[model samples]
Target: MERERESVSAMFGAVPEAAGMARDVLREALEKWEVRKGADDAALVLTELVTNAIRHGTTISVRVVRERDDALRLEVADGSRDLPRPRTASTEDEDGRGMLIVTALALDWGVRPFLGGKTVFALLKVG
Candidate 1:
């Protein structure tokens, strides 16, 4: 059976609920795309991106697009123009490992300017 492709976009406040909402959106998108492998990893990345936007940016938006080639692209846009960097962290550090995990798991990922802000995206291969 051919899998159906879909896309979803949302904008939310820089609040705690936004992360949960982003996760929910990702879950729905993944289900629609029938891509189960590494879904948890994707969810984690979504949370990290949303949380970073809420914490560091004045506004945030998320977009999930499923390509005809069976690739799922997840993008998180925020008001901040600064690009994200995955830095080495001390074992004792409470945070700073989110982007590292993304870089490790995503098939491909990067950042780009969007609507006077910046958007970080990850492309995940789906079946």
Candidate 2:
């Protein structure tokens, strides 16, 4: 397999503003990589990951890597060691739908554990 990759990584404090910054960074990175087809979905999924991190951790770092010609992998690492689980949201519920959206958009996703925290990742196939 031929490998062509570009990556963007940044650290953000746990705050509401981090989500928007992440989206902007992802948008610019995708544009630079010429992978605009799934930019909206990518931004949405990135927002959810960052938001979740801000809620549970003190500091977060997000990395988006263009894995190949058509695959992009997004990883959000946080100070918390907890892994996220997808849950079925109630009809009247306003939350718990983030991971569902991720599952629907990503080709595959998973979590990786490190010494002091964990990284949640989603892979999107965008040509």
Predicted structure with the largest TM-score when compared to the true one: 2
Q: Per-residue lDDT tens digits of candidate 2, residues 1-127?
A: 6557889999999999999999888988987887878888888889989998999947989999999978889999998988888899999998999888888898888999999999999998887
- Going through the candidates in order, what is the number of backbone clashes in each? 0, 0
RMSD of 2: 1.5
- The TM-score of predicted model 1 comes to 0.87
Q: RMSD in angstroms, candidate 1?
A: 2.0
Q: Record all residue pairs in model 2 with backbone atoms less than 3 Å apart, i.e. clashing.
A: none
- Candidate 1's residue-wise lDDT over 1-127, tens digit each? 5545678999998888999999999898778667787678778878888877887747778998876546778899988887888999999998889888888878888999876789999887665
Point out where model 2 deviates above 4 Å.
1-3
TM-score of 2: 0.94
